[model samples]
Target: MTIRKATFDETQRILDYALVVLKESTMGFVKPRVEIANLIMAPILADGGYYLIYEKNRTIHGWIGVGTIYDSYSEEVVGTIPEVYVFPAYRGQGVAEKLFHEAFRHLKTENVNKVQLNVFAGNHAKKLYEKIGFHDVSTLMEKDLD
Candidate 1:
C-alpha cells in the first residue's frame, strides 16, 4: 500500500467515501448540510493542513484529514485530526497506522506543537490511537434537543 496526499480534483470521491463511513459508524446521528469537500479543501488550499489517503493498486483504501488550529490566546498552532476512516474492507489491516505516520511526518515539518482528535466512546479505533501515543485529555458530551 502507498500513502499520498489527496488532490482537489478528487475531493468529491473522497467526500463520498468519508460520508459513508460517517453515517455507518455514527448511525446517522451526525448530519451536516454544508459541503464537506469545502471543509477538507479549505485547510489544504490555505497551506495549513492536509488530507492523506492510503491506496493500493490505484484504489483508495482509507483516509485521514488533519486541520490546523491557531490559538490566539496562547499564540500556538496545533494540528487537529478531524477524521480518519478506513474502508470496512480495509479495517484491521494497519492502514490507519500507516496513514497516521505519514500525517505526523508532515505535521512535524510544520512545527505543530501538538495534535488532537476526537473519538466516540464506543469506537474501537480509540485503542489504536492510544497505542500510537495519544491519551485522553478530555471528554466531550452532547445533548440532543430535537
Candidate 2:
C-alpha cells in the first residue's frame, strides 16, 4: 500500500467516503446532510488544507484530512484532524493509524503546536485514538426539547 497527497480531482471521491463516515459514526445536528458535509470539507482544499490517501494496487483504501485551527484558549495555531475514514474492507489493517501518523508528521512540519479531533460517543475508532495518545480535554452535552 502507498500513502500520498490527494489531488483536487479526487475531492468528490473523498467526499463520498466522508459522507459514509459521517452517516455511520456521527449524531450531528444538521439538515440537508450533503450540504453540511460539503460545507465542512470544502474549505480544506481552498485554503491550503490537505488530505493523505492510502491506496493499494491503485485503488484508494482510506484517507485522512489535516488542517489548521486557531485555538482560542491557547492563542496558537493547532492542527485539526477533521476526518479519518477507511473502507470497511480495509478496516483492522492499520490504515487509519498510518494516515493519522502521516497527518501528524505533516503538521509538525507546519509548526503546529498540537492537534485535536472530535470523536462521537461510542464510535469504535475512539479506542484507537486514545491508543494514539489523545485524551479528553472537555465534553459537549445537549438535550433536545420539543
Candidate 3:
C-alpha cells in the first residue's frame, strides 16, 4: 500500500473515512459522529499535520488524522496522531502501520522527534502501540467544557 498526504480534493473521502472510524471503532459517543467529522475534517485537510490517506495500487483504503503530537505539558509538538483507522474490512492488514510510518517520516523532517497520542485505558490499540515502541506515561484526565 502507498500513503500520501490527502489533498483538499479528497475532502469528502476523508470525512467518510473519519466517520467510519468514529462509528466502528468507538462506542457510547453521544455526538453525531458524521456531523463532527464533517465539521472538523476540512480545514485540517487544507493544512498539514500529518493527515494521510492510504491506498493500495491506487485504490482508496482508509486514512489517519493527527494534530501536533507533542509534549503533553510543554505545548511543543513532538508528534501527533489525532485519529487513525483502516476500514473495518481492511483492518488486520497492517494498513495503519504503513500510514504511521509515512507520517512519521514526514514529522521527522519537521523536527518532530517524539510521537504522542491518547487512547482510552482499555482500547485494544494500546497493545498495538506498545508493540510498536510506544509506552504508557500517564492517563488523561478531563472535564466537561461549558
Candidate 4:
C-alpha cells in the first residue's frame, strides 16, 4: 500500500469517506452529516491543509485530513488532524497508523509544534490513538436540550 496527498479532484470522494467516519464516531451529537463534511473539508481544499489517501494497487482504502490551526488557549500554532478513516475491511491492518504518521511528517515540515485530534467517548479508535502516543488534554462535555 502507498500513501499520498489527494488531489483537488478527489475531494468529493474523500468527503464521502469522511461522512461515514462522522456518522460512526459522532454518537449523534452532530447533525446533518453532509454539511458537516463540507465544512470540515472546505478549508483543507482551499489551502493550508491536506487530504491524504492510502491505496493499494491504485484502489483507495483509507484517507486522512490534516492541517495547521491557531490554538487560542495554547497561544501557538498546532497541527490539527480533523478526520481519519479506513474502510471496514481495511481496519486492523495498520492503515490508520500509517496515515497518522504520514500526516505528522507533513505537519512537521510546516513547523507545527504539536498535533491534536478529537475523539468521541466510546469510540474504539481512542485506544488506538493512545497507543500511537496521543494523550487526553481536555474534555468536551455536552448536554442535550429538548
- Writing each residue's lDDT as its tens digit, candidate 4 over 44-125 gives 5566787889999988888889888788998999999888888899999999999999999999888887999999888889
Task: Give lDDT for model 4.
Answer: 0.85
TM-score of each: 0.80, 0.92, 0.77, 0.92
- Predicted candidate 3 versus true structure: per-residue lDDT over 50-97, tens digit per residue: 468898877777777755533658778677676787777788988888
Error of 3 at 107 (Å): 0.4
Q: What is the TM-score of candidate 1? A: 0.80
Candidate 1 vs candidate 3: the TM-score winner is: 1
Candidate 4 regions with alpha-carbon error over 4 angstroms = none
- In candidate 3, stretches whose alpha carbon ends up further than 4 angstroms from where it belongs are 34-47, 69-72, 141-146
Looking at candidate 3, the ten consecutive residues that score lowest on lDDT are 23-32
- Tens-digit per-residue lDDT, 20-43, candidate 2: 767766855443377777777677
Q: What is the C-alpha lDDT of each candidate?
A: 0.76, 0.84, 0.69, 0.85
C-alpha RMSD of each candidate structure in angstroms: 2.8, 1.6, 3.5, 1.5
Give candidate 1 misplaced runs (Cα > 4 Å): 25-29, 32-47, 72-75, 143-146
lDDT for 50 in candidate 1 is: 59
Q: After superposition, how far is residue 38 of candidate 1 from its true place, in Å?
A: 6.2
User: Residue 61 deviation, candidate 2, in Å?
Assistant: 0.8
Cα lDDT of candidate 3 equals 0.69
